[model samples]
Target: MDQTTTTTAKKVLCIEDEHFIGELYARALTKGGYEVKVVIDGSEGLKEARTNQYDIILLDLMVPNVTGMEILKQLRDPSQPALKAKIIITTNLEQKEETRTAIEQQADGYLIKAEVTPKQLVGILDTLN
Candidate 1:
């Protein structure tokens, strides 16, 4: 008898308004065996995220139409259904200490966009699983 093992790829949603950054993460994550979806607008991203279908959500603090902070607040609100996806705050914006602490309290992980490379992002996701 023969046996085989298979693992389902983790689905990732990247909410980034920067085209270059979004594509870069998407390419690297896809290469790392993750099913990656990139949304350029915060409103659209939030809509997709509300579906609760992704395993991870990489949220940029400065997206258009709606801010990532707003999305985070809505998703983490007790009024909504519990979210199964790990929300990682990815941004280059420098926040006040109080704001940062608030964000950190709700997010699974926080990464500065300027400091992390695409490869490093993939590595971080690997550890999350």
Candidate 2:
């Protein structure tokens, strides 16, 4: 008789363009018991998401090459929700339409970057469930 055990870390994928902000988040989340993968470019970010499984996705609403909304749509597509992961969109822009649009696309949560700190951001992940 053998007892088997496996350890899996919570994985968080961060799709953000700002170098300082992205690095700030990766470091903060990494300290909060998550395995963090940060991608700065929109196209590369999409590729990374497709190739990985993440418990949560922290995305910037404004990214080049592939807008965050496009990424959200791709993730939540009914044809392939098998790969769908919990998404949280963060942005400096605070338009009601953007919030409504993000909710329509299935973002688990939305945060205004100007109003959040790295610590608060990490704390927010605890509410994802």
Candidate 3:
């Protein structure tokens, strides 16, 4: 029998306000062979997103200090032009208008948090790769 090993782990940034949700996602993603970073504060998450390159970012819309829309705007801004991380909005917000706006802002994907389990989320990320 032969075994294959992966040399690199996919990096994931989870910007979620709920501590339990964050931990759940981090644990699930880690189990799925990803390097996960969870930030409960939107401002700090935004700062980190702007500075580091990740394979994917799981963002929540209603977070403390800064809105996820604002973070998306900054990340998609043509002025910066260097941030290329794929951003996926994982929020409980269920508004068609907001979804449209997120799509317009170049969000890679959107998911209703209430509808997705951590394992399902990992499956989605796998498709992206």
Candidate 4:
């Protein structure tokens, strides 16, 4: 008799323009038993997020082509199909008080890039559920 248990790894999409930060997140999340896909631009990130295939999405505010703020708005729009993935804002840039409040209200989580370590990021993901 053989007893084997197979658990699917949680899928994580990391949208960060900083190559180093993206890589760091990919490595940490992978090590934490998640399948991670890192995209360096907001255009690609928005495209991927629209698929609604991931369980978690780590988004950065500033990126090429499109901004993360726009992506979040689109995802949260009632006109579009709802997304199952939780969107977490990961950014170093500071926004206005009102803007920050608005974003925090929409996002599942928010973290400062300079304050959070890659390992801490993985831990944060674990707590999201």
Per-residue lDDT over 90-120 for candidate 1, one digit per residue giving the tens place of the 0 to 100 score: 9998999988988988889999988999999
* Model 3 lDDT at residue 52: 86
Model 2 C-alpha lDDT versus the unseen true structure = 0.84
Decoy 4 TM-score against native: 0.94
List ranges where model 2 is wrong by over 4 Å.
1-7, 96-99
Please tell me which model should have the higher TM-score, number 1 or number 3. 1
**For model 3, what is the alpha-carbon lDDT of residue 30?**
96
The predicted structure with the larger TM-score, 2 or 4, is 4
Error of 2 at 100 (Å): 2.0
**What is the C-alpha local distance difference test score of candidate 3?**
0.88
Model 4: CA > 4 A from native: none
TM-score against native, each model: 0.96, 0.86, 0.90, 0.94
Candidate lDDT (C-alpha), each: 0.94, 0.84, 0.88, 0.91
Number of residue pairs clashing in candidate 2, backbone atoms closer than 3 angstroms, sequence gap of 3 or more or interchain: 0
lDDT by residue (tens digit), candidate 3, 1-129: 889995898899999999999999999999999999999898999999978889899989889999888888888888886676899988887757865766656888989998999999999999996
In terms of TM-score, which candidate is strongest? 1
State how far residue 47 of model 3 sits from its true place (Å).
0.8
lDDT order, best first, reads 1, 4, 3, 2
